[model samples]
Each structure stands twice: as structure tokens, then as C-alpha cells.
Target: MKKFALYSLFAMASFSSLAHAESVLSFGVDPTFPPFESKTANGNLVGFDIDLGNAICQHLKMKCVWVETAYDSIIPALDAKKFDAVLSAMSINEKRKAQVDFSDMLYNTPSVLVAKKGSNLQPTVDSLKGKTIGVAQGTTQEAYAKGEWQGKGVDVVSYQNQDFVNQDLISGRVDATLTDSATATAGFLNTPQGKDFAFSGKPLTDTHYLGEGAAIALRKGDADRVKMINSALAQMHKDGTYQMLEKKYFTFDVYNKKP
Candidate 1:
């Protein structure tokens, strides 16, 4: 999706006791990142991440304060204590682990190549020959698109976010684009411009590039918050609540595995 600029807003309180003895939790996100977290037309932030965050906050009988920031700065902002936790669609990996800790895998997703529907865009090093592909800058998807397709006919076009990429795709500005599979499905196919588009190709599943599953971003040594988020996620998965939310926006569970 779109990598929003620094929205720079204070969400709810950091870590103080809440009203009626409950605890308040803060979650930061890149609001323009769709199918995960993004602002609705009515100005409300609603998406899979929002719903999942809200559910976790509710189950804990606390409030969820959302902070919107640039995708590139989210980790640093979180480490600076701008927010207590990151509910943004951040993946867990070694690079991130050195700076901050993450909760257990909350959801899984894969990266896919999106192009005009019925186009013969195969997932091969050669298929991208002479093709211009779009990707959100600073994302793992961007790295994968460039590194994997470099030296081939693939030309990488980086956009600030998902919406603009879709716009260019509809106008035939780019031959294809690569993004999260979940986003390709919910954010693209459901939109007007994406009605004529579909993501074709096998998922890019290099762990070094895409990382493992997605998790909540937290400060290093913040074990308490991590446990709380992990517990909530485990409950959701156990009770099938995770799949329920997945179906609300997707045809199948796209988490925890590569396509």
C-alpha cells in the first residue's frame, strides 16, 4: 500500500493505568497502508490491522490509541517511545530484532506481482524483461522486486504508496507492480481501478527478503507488552477469530505461509 508521510500525531497515553483499573495501550501504524491499516473515506482508520488491534485492546478491556507515521520511520519512532507498540504491517526479522523486539507471529502474508488482468506476467526472472514494475519505496517488497529482477528486463518504479501505484497501473504507466498479496486482493481488487487488474505469478518467498510472518513491533526488552499482544493473538487464532477477520476481507487465510 501507500507509504504515508510523517503524520506526526500523539496517540493515546503511553503506559499508565486506565480508567476502572484497565490498562491503556498504544499502537502506531502507517494509515495509508491498506488491507492492513488505512484511513477510510469517513476519516476512520479501519482495516485488518485496525480490526485486529481493536480486538486485542477490547479483550484486554483497555483503549487503543493509533499513531500514524511514515513507514520508514515507524521503527525509530517506536524505539523513541512515540508509541508503545506498532500494529503496522511490519515483518519480523534479524535486522529489526537487533533494535527492537516483536511479539509472536500475529499474521502471515506473501508478496506477489500485480498486473493487468489476463496479462501473461509469469513469475520468472525473464518474464519481467522489458517490464516496468512498481513497488512502495523502503518496503521489503521493493527490495525483492529490485534485487530479484535486477539485470533482467525488469525496471523498478518506486511509489510512495499503493494508491498512486494503482493509479499509474490503470493509466498503463507501468507494466506491473509488486506488493503484499493481501493488499493486492482487498485494497486493489475491491477498488474501481483494480477491477480490471489481478496479481499473477507465484509468491516471492525468500525468507531473507520477505522475512517470516508479521508481528507487533515493540521496544527491546518490553517483554510484558509483547506477551500481552502474543496472548491476544494466540486466543484469536485458537478460537478461529483470526480466520473470521481474514474472511471478512479475503477469500482464504493468506497469513503464515508463502503462496
Candidate 2:
């Protein structure tokens, strides 16, 4: 019957739609770092990295799923298939490259030492000889401080998250905190609580510890995913989507010029 034929065609179309449903890309993020990725009071994730990831997903026509994970263990979680990639403002360096692949550069910023105004503290070991410095655990800042200052009489304290490090710094528990210059400016120095703090020394340029810039971290051997992300990123750059997002969070260019 004609009615039966119509029903059959409709069912087939529904099946096809289900079979071709949009794929999903899950990104792991540690929401402790603000102006990058952090949770709102309403539990919504918002930041430049979140915006970037969402844009990539939109370009790829995939659903975006954000997985909250600690920064220290995000790599392990990615390896365990807990997420497809990490978009948590992770720096791409030889050390991290050994464990995972990374997309093209996202943004680059320098690391600086933040201390009370007029503290006259430099990042040098001699200046901080008897002082305490706070650093986020599993970050390049922690590695740099521990390697260069810890054994040289500078007490380097490691906090689980950057927020904790900032809190301790405000409480005077730590003489200073080493963190990204942009974050120090936006998340701390710009706030009323940070009114008395200022960057102590010049930006640290030891690529051995600081790495080059931030990028999306993917699981090792996930070349397909990496390629897909790179393609989307290229399109974003070509269409000025990247610059649009960058302007939303930063006044200066976070995407450093390539050599």
C-alpha cells in the first residue's frame, strides 16, 4: 500500500539520521586557572581556552564535551581514554612531547615572579635566598623553581592549583609566586586583593624549563585527531576567528610571532 511505503521511507530516513549523528570531541581541562579556563559561580566553564575549544568543535561540526580534570593528571587521563584531548593551556615542550602529541601553538606568554610592591625581590637565587616562592604543582614554574631555587636556600612551595598558590601568596605564607605573566596581570595583579603585588623581575626565558608556548595536548599516536585539530585551527587563523577570541580575553597578542 502507498501508506506502508511512506512509513517505510520515513523510518529509513530516521535511521540514517541516527547513524550519521554528529560526533563528539571531549576536552580535558583543569578549571583552576582563570582567564584561561575556570568555572563560574553557576558551574559553567568559561575562559579563552574554553572559547577556543568550542570554536574548534563548531568548525569540525562536532559536539563539544568538557571534562574537568586536575592539571597534574590530565595527561594520564588522556592516555586512559578519559578524554580525547587536553585544551587546558598546557605548554608544549620536549618533556611533554615525550608523553603526548600537541597541536600547533595556541599562545605564548612569559613567566614572572610576583611579590608585594617594593619587595625588591628578583628571581635570582641570591635575591630569594631566604624567601619562599609558591608554584603550581606539575607546572613548568614548579619545575623551574625546584630545579633552580629549591636547593639554593629558597623555599619553593608547591600548591595543587594556581588559585591556592595565589591565596598563599596573599596570606604572606609565600614571599612570591611564579606564574604566567598574563595570568599574574589578569587574575591577580588586576584584582583588588592583588593591589599591593607587582612583578619582581624580568620574564624567565629558560626554554629548557618554560617551553615555547601553549597548545592542545593530544594522546600519543592520535595523529588523526591531531591532524583534524590542526586543520580546524588553520581555518580559524585564516578567518580571523583566532584573533576574535584573543581579543575577547587579551589586549596584547598572546599568539607570539613565529621565527
TM-score to true structure, per model = 0.84, 0.90
In terms of lDDT, model 2 sits at 0.89
In model 2, where do residues sit more than 4 Å from their true spots? 1-22, 257-259
If candidate 2 were superposed on the true structure by all CA atoms, what would the RMSD be? 8.4
Model 1 agreement with the true structure over 57-168: per-residue lDDT tens digits: 8766788899887777888899888888888888776777787898887677887888888897976778888888888866788777777886676888888877777789
lDDT of 2 by residue, 33-77 (tens): 778988989999999999999999888778899999988888999
Model 1: runs farther than 4 Å from truth? Answer: 1-22, 151-153, 255-259
| CA lDDT scores, all candidates in order | 0.78, 0.89
Compared to the true structure, candidate 1 yields what TM-score?
Answer: 0.84
User: Candidate 1 — what's its lDDT?
Assistant: 0.78
Total clashes for model 2: 0
- Output the TM-score of candidate 2: 0.90
Clashing pairs in 2: none
